[model samples]
Target: MSADPGSPSAAQVELDGVERVFHLGDSDVHALRDLHLRIGAGEYVAVMGPSGSGKSTLLNILGLLDRPNGGRYRLEGRDVTTLSLEEQAQVRSRRIGFVFQSFHLVPRLTAAENIGLPMMLAGIAPRERAERVARALKDYGLEDRARHKPDELSGGQRQRVAIARATIMAPALILADEPTGNLDRSTGVEVVRLLEALNARGVTLIVVTHDPQLGARARRRLLMEDGAIKHDTMAAETV
Candidate 1:
């Protein structure tokens, strides 16, 4: 889809003085220190960093999997840091999508069942759930593999299933952690193209990757060190 001319370029994610600290014995390890960031809707952002630089920590906080010891996180103009555990879960389920390095599909479930997990947890009716799952299977090129388990699908197919599951709820923000890390170069490229297609459709895409090649594809790149954003720059039309 083409960009919407009238769509407002507004802040979708806002972070201010965000701090995360892990206490180990008597020592406190600062994972994120006074981090401040703002991301606009429909923006494709990539985060690159070395190991132990708190890349995972940032992603965890953004996904609401971990809480900051200090500061505020405002999503779509509402503060989420203060929300209770259940309240935060509700927001995370509806407003955010997560794609991990591992294809976290249930081994016991079929491809179609895995893709429809979110709606099932959300308590959607059986008929509508079946219809949406059918469309998702076709949309993600898993129609023939609908009844197959994760072990039965190829690596790319597994990642595709994971992607389908992530976006099934139509979340506004997608947090991808090393999405292509598990695939070969060729298959990784295919997986990335699928992600880019979703970004083009106006979802906010943030990818955390160690591969410079993958990071360069994003319009904006963020370099992290010591849990802080060291560099933020715009790349050329490398996509």
Candidate 2:
């Protein structure tokens, strides 16, 4: 377990006066309202809220997939809000990893290829990419399934591959949305434990889950309501 919300530093993520708005028919919808929060490096945090609480919107903004209508987003002391679309995509590809509830593996690609996809996109050297992919496959216990396609693997195995793929780029941050949503209880726990292992190695992890039991496992739990943070509690670190 980590500390109880240890003091955030320049290395941490800062969201200052973030706002997101969308137009719905003839009206305006405020998805996020002047949200300000900081998440330190190596922290395993969970965000919880109902369906319409702007959880996905916030996650998208954090992941750099969507831009905020207003506010500055600084990642590792660099202002990224003003970057061009291509630059933002590059930053996201190089700095962030994403794991969604639905394993987004391409049906045509093998497990090994899927794990190496990010590195391939980043134009990493073939030998280095191969090395990382091998390690990732072995680390996630997918070596035996390296040649198998997603359709052939079990749910747990597919999720494992997804996790491996997410971290193979050695991303600074991992954003997981309902990672365990499609798995059984035992398998879900296993998946989460694998994620925690990565966090233990210093990658910032933020998980969005609707399950209280799952959220409670994190050191910091953020409760959201109506597109705003209702409460954020730092629990005693679990030994």
Candidate 3:
């Protein structure tokens, strides 16, 4: 990575000739069509579109949660389209982090436990997990709430916990889908700021959102409609 964030080098994620079709009873629903995208490290990009514009479908493919019916996808220079499901899962765990509209915190787990869940799943040592979890709690201002379960936290706090968990593994790419959708405007702004700060540190940030104001804040914007990219632009100031 270079000091210039926008300069293209080895892409974090790439899609070429990507097409996604879904079977709806008998008819085929085209969700994404011939989409080509390259996201470089440290870039802050936003994907925007109305409902049924294939935004979520595109995101699913980027996160390796779904496969395109046709085309190729490369993640960190590896041709991921050829990997098995288990292999894809490993790659996703190692390189990608996701935050959804809903906080998606485990209702049964405390904030600290939820933040440490990824490390736990990867079989990290108890001592190291405790150390990392402690840092995450303080970094995200959740130290005081570490013992609070999801039901005990506010909406903003829950989202913060989710963000903390998502970044715990230090993934190369963070894919956020309406990360602030469920929060109030002020809280949403705060969450967005946190995500931007992460991007400033060279973590690739790709956000999908229906809010135009939120989308425009990104350095680069991609608009999708009818299962294809309708417009792609980089802010003049970003260049």
Candidate 4:
């Protein structure tokens, strides 16, 4: 998946001839078929599809949580498909961030601890990690909730902590899987705005959602069906 020759910015993500297959018992299920996609920096993309349409599979591959059985994935001009598990983990930690519907915060960790987990895992110095976590807590309006555990926070607060944790490394890309699925309408709207704000600040944001309303908020939309991109708003706009 190459960037358009005339495009201004470089592609942040590229997938070419990507294929993902899963074997269950005696059958093989094709999760993604010849999937090709290119997303530029600072773009806001929404991936929407029915169940079993490979939306989750696509997100997994993008986040390096899973690999495609066939094809190439290039991130920031580097072909990551060939990278080993350790190498992929390194890239994932430094370049990609993930926000999940469930928040996925460690139950025992406080909000500040959760936001600092990535830096801690990457072996960042304690002083630096503490400073970054403090900044994140303030940036996300979680300063007062710093010592509260996940179970002690509200839905919106929990999601804010997850987002702060995800972006603490200043990743080039943010992969959000149903980020607002767990919140009520108003809270979900707030979470979506926070994510959009990140995109506004030049972070590539890709969100997977079942809500049409939520999907519509993205600048570009990819509609997938049967393991293939059925519609691309960007392509449509160009025509």
Candidate 5:
């Protein structure tokens, strides 16, 4: 559970009549169909569905990795749907963090280095990068594994590093797509707790998962079918 039941903050995400279509061999695949959704600041949301249902497409649009073919998307009150590619990239770098199923850590980089990658890309000074990375390492309990590469770390440690890296930019929104897909049940539990801890600190968390048990833990659950949300409900009694 993330956002409080009576949150006063404005919406962090807003979509109006959103549509996404992919053209494949003269066939139009409607990935998202007139979708409209809003997530308030600090909300924790889980999107769930079968493989072809469009949960990934919706997450992509929210993360600014994919643009919608039609309709408006406002992120933090700005019209992101109309942003140029460069502008969108800038926004993404500054305000969004992404966690993927594969962990997405650079194979060659040490855990500390990977955690600091975003700041490095943004041209942060070395001292600042070092300070932030060190703090993140401690925050994620990765100090002992700082020098380890992704291959050297266990599944849970790697995911912790990925999460550290994702949040090092101080992103307002964290988009996790199947974050625990590659991990065992206990490790997945650890990762989910880490995500929820960040959410407790007021960062908006949106996770895409097929696991029903995991989805039930969120304050809000959305079920997608046929490129649209079939169900959207807040927890009556949080699990």
Candidate 6:
């Protein structure tokens, strides 16, 4: 289903009978099986499951980083399952933001340059890129560290820079995978609060985490097992 154009939310995602299979040496492993899901715009959702339960696979599919072997995916009301590689890349660049546990920032680039990388890759003009990067750095409380490279920053600082870069594109959806896995308890809390703030501002946020404390903070939760959703908090709530 599509989001209302006049609504404050910006994106909607739907998956119908999606399946993903990987070939091992002589056997096939199903990573996702007939998984059907819908995420409305501006929702805060946590995906929780044990290792090999398909949490990361699900995130990859939603972020357009991987294609499903069966079924269809619709994002913002358009069937994106069949888009060409170039088309998918275009859509991913403009519409999706991702935060990883390792804080995937360029080791050689300074914070400002890293934050501006997406715009640069998209061929945005230098002046506009600089302006937006500056705003993001300030917004993420990394203004003072803009000139610092990743190695020079602390774990928390590096994560802040990563978050800034992720959001610089103003993406309709933000996907975070173990976003706080490398930080201390306090720092992790700080990082999650930052993500939550973005969600509060109407960005769709989906997080994959093993931390029950962190998962509990989401408005809705999905429990995955054997490549399918075993429980959905929203569905239970409605019933």
Give a tens-digit lDDT track for model 1, residues 68-162.
99999998889999999999999888778888889999999999999889889988888887887888788888899999999999999999999
Residue 57 of model 2 has an lDDT of: 94
Runs in model 1 lying further than 4 Å from the true structure: 1-11
Q: What is the lDDT of residue 3 in candidate 4?
A: 10
Error of 2 at 214 (Å): 0.7
How would you encode candidate 4's per-residue C-alpha lDDT over 166-191 as one tens digit per residue?
Answer: 88887888999999999999999989
Per-candidate TM equals: 0.95, 0.94, 0.94, 0.93, 0.95, 0.94
In model 4, pairs of residues that clash are none
Taking all chains together, the TM-score of candidate 3 against the true structure is 0.94
Superposed model 6: Cα runs more than 4 Å off: 1-9, 235-239
What's the residue-level lDDT of 38 in candidate 6? 94
Worst 10 residues of 3 by lDDT: 1-10
- Tens digits of per-residue lDDT, candidate 2, 19-109, equal 9999999999999999998998888899999999989999999889999999988888788999999999998887788999999999999
Clashing pairs in 2: none
Off by over 4 Å in 5: 1-11
Q: Provide C-alpha RMSD values for all models, in order.
A: 3.1, 4.3, 4.0, 5.4, 3.7, 4.1
Our tally of clashes for model 5 stands at 0
Give stretches of model 3 more than 4 Å off: 1-11
Model 5: which residue pairs collide? Answer: none
Candidate 4 residues lying further than 4 Å off, grouped into runs, are: 1-11, 235-239
RMSD of 5: 3.7
